[model samples]
Target: MTKQQIWEWFANHSKQILDFLLFLALVSMGAFVKILKQVRQGAKASWKWFLAEAIVSFFVALLVYGFFDQFMQTSTLFTYVVCAWCGSFSTIFHKRMEDLLGAIFDKLKQLISEKKSL
Candidate 1:
């Protein structure tokens, strides 16, 4: 298709396109929050780390979307790419958190058993 054809198509679907982008952004932000919680754990929660991660994720996402908007004309495909990246990162973050929790639980159980033996 010609350049005019593409521009016209984008114009017609601009609202839907923007809505999807906003949705992806919201989901990514929510995932970041969950990851932050996981990283906190029991007494190791650090506000500095949390804020740093938040800032980094924000800039990274913005840079990615901006690059795509400037260099790529396929908005739908770009949306899917963002969604996939965020979803995968969130899943991995959750798994790591689960592992951390399990380790903490195991340590607690060991402590309890040792106390009982005393």
Candidate 2:
């Protein structure tokens, strides 16, 4: 399609597009947490974990979006911030937080190793 046609189509469907993107972002966040958990535990990432992550992400997205829609009624920046916070908060529990933080530090260590090797 032409650029103009694509632009018009996107404008018409912007809300739907934005919602889908937000859903995908939430799913990614869930998957990231699962991956971090696996990494901390020395387990491999697999499709089973991914599917579980997706399911949790779907409900989290619904709760976040529904809450904002019901109460705050859609300011763009607020929606974005709250959705991001929801993704982060949903992933982190008390015990998992320490593991996740340590995993992050390990990644940083790896980065430092690479820099030293270079």
Candidate 3:
């Protein structure tokens, strides 16, 4: 294609690219909100746990990106895998937090009942 034709095509598609980026940003924000809700529901709000998750996620992301850069070198496939892994990991982590919260609640209730009967 001619230079003029390439320039015209880019001009026409720039808005679409911007819109897609905005959509991705919104999706990320939504996911973060969901994760926060799960963290809040846990038995205790521990900074240690938050820090650990952050560290793990950072290392995981770096490892994946490095591996892809070294071998696959396919941006599209790397993005897809990262998104899928992040989504699945978030879901599992949230469920585990909920379970821990439930267990804590049960124990607290039992303790209260025992105290009331004493």
How badly does each model clash, as a count of residue pairs? 0, 0, 0
Q: Where in model 3 is the C-alpha error above 4 Å?
A: 1-37, 40-43, 76-118
Instruction: Predict model 2's lDDT versus the native.
Output: 0.70
Give per-residue CA lDDT, model 2, range 1-118, as digits (tens). Answer: 9999999999999998987787667557655765576668777667886666556655665677778878879875566556655654555543586898999999999999999999
The residue-by-residue lDDT of candidate 3 on 9-91, one tens digit each, is 98999977774565355435434554576677773456876555545444444455466656777665445456435542565
Candidates by lDDT, descending order: 2, 1, 3
Whole-model Cα lDDT of every candidate shown, in order: 0.64, 0.70, 0.60
lDDT of 1 at 95: 67
Q: Name the candidate that leads on lDDT.
A: 2
Q: Estimated TM-score per prediction? A: 0.40, 0.50, 0.37
Best by TM-score: 2
Candidate 3 global lDDT: 0.60
lDDT of 1: 0.64
The alpha-carbon root-mean-square deviation between model 3 and the true structure, to one decimal in Å, is: 13.2
Report the C-alpha displacement of residue 113, candidate 3, in angstroms. Answer: 45
Give the clashing residue pairs of candidate 3, or none. Answer: none
